[model samples]
Target: MRSSSPSPAPPVDLAKARRVAVEAAEAAGDLLRAGMARPLEIRPKGTAGDVVTELDLAAEALILRRLRAVYPGHRVIAEESGVNEGTGTAAGADAGLVWLVDPLDGTNNVAIGMPVYAVGLALCAGPVPVLGVVHDPVTRRTWSAVRGEGARGPDGAPLRLAAAARAGRADNPVLAWTQGHEVGRGDPVVLPLRTAVEARCGRLLQLWAPLVAWVMLARGDIDGIVGYRPELVDLPAGALLAKEAGAEFRALDGGPYEPSIDLPPAERGFVAARPALLERLLETTAQACRPAAAGTGSTGGTEGTGGSAGAGGSGGAAQGGRVRLTR
Candidate 1:
């Protein structure tokens, strides 16, 4: 509940949130890489357990008509027009500047072709997400961020975002999980990321977004990342680009990120590694979002906000590891 209205930090240029999210994430990554492997109309959104295609409303109508043709008083909380300019329950300072579109994060791995998927854009002025882009258009690669003039890639180049609080102990550390948390009974956070990726022998990459694992932990190439179901359109531009790339975002119930457009869809989230491995991965993702295990296996995808890839993952590799935790 912290919004005393001061957050104007970081780079925050608002370069129209990187030219309207890199032209709607490269036109929704060219209609998801020309319908990768082909055939997809899909369609289902809640009872069938959510789904949609036509390239997510053609990339949410080209990112809501290019952000209402240059911030038309800016207001958009998307995942498909849930709230555009006004309605009810849509709060991001009632539109002082908002556009948290996830035009196509990982529509179930882009309907199974598995190019990973991505196209997230953040730019909130009221609830404090200064600006962020995450395009991947199947490797066209973007990844912008701007809260204190940091986070950049593709065309702009400059990607560093690392603050690393010197805690040490990440042997392999490229872990991320989400698919079993309905109030725990079985998911004590996948037994500490399968015990820190089998005690650092690591290499179990699964991409489903979480802002492309916080832009591969600000390009350090994923020393640590974990998520259990986060939203607020997936954590304010990758938690301010993993705190300007010095990483460490906790909330296995430690709680804080309170930006809402109506918030309650059964809230859940977690992130770890970087700061004593995020206090033991937030105590194993808060025992896997407790409630004595409501479902199981954490399922997979949506909720790790933002987007992109072209290098990053498996914790520490980046000369071109080509990482993209989720589109």
Candidate 2:
């Protein structure tokens, strides 16, 4: 990787792109919803908990078609279908743009008739996510956000948590936990971190469906999210959504989260919460990751906003936001 910060990306018609992404995600979600009640040809993608169904493939194809039809020059990465190098790549070299898609984010839940699932998509300019759209066909709700813009729900209004919801109750905090597929149950770093957080929080939820958990966090239904090396495919969209919804996505070392499509798995985990709850979340994170950071654990390295993280400056508000909303 280059040892220098990336130059600023030129502005584009991101509003139009956001519309296209929202449409694609919703359409794919509709497909998933329609197929949910039917018998699925489910198969293991890898570990026992990870699975894929025919609906996942169908939904991905539906979303990919909508996306390619609009931006054929942009790179497209989908969960089920292979990457479309087209005129761009995830490296953002050709067109300096990439789209990340997870047409059915909760395939395991969907396979088992669980009502929690969503269709997710994101647009990245170089390494930074500029737009994100996540749709839940079951509830017919869609959440979207542009990099500098605030997050929005299906009603097209900014998503703001009530004061009570934003408060992280010291005695009853609820948190969502996410882990990458590669991290085994016995992972040294994850096991310790998970144990620590679980002990403190009144309730700990690990949905395996990260996008769903992200929505819960963004909407302030949960206190925070403690992701232990989440997948890149699901990270860009959900992280953008939460950040725009007046929440912060911070590295375990308390550095600002400047996500890149190129970071190593060890660098991808984070803690997300509204500012009111950030310090507490960070305190928990620091305590949990202290041992891991001393070794070769997933979240060991100190993260810089530039250089290896592929950012030139802070990509957050008021310096980094566009569609600003008062907290």
TM-score of each: 0.30, 0.84
Expressed as tens digits, the lDDT of each residue in 117-160 for candidate 2 is 77789888766787888888889899988776678888999886
The local distance difference test score of model 1 is 0.55
Query: Cα lDDT of model 2 overall?
Result: 0.68
lDDT of 1 by residue, 1-327 (tens): 112335564323467567767777778778777766578988755332345678777777777887766555556767655556733343232446666777676676666676766677777665567777877777778777776666677768767644453234255456554322122324344455445444443554556555666666677666666554444464566666556545556555455434332333233344544555666655555554543244433322222221221111111001111112111
**Highest-TM-score candidate:** 2
By lDDT, the best candidate is 2
lDDT of 2 at 139: 93
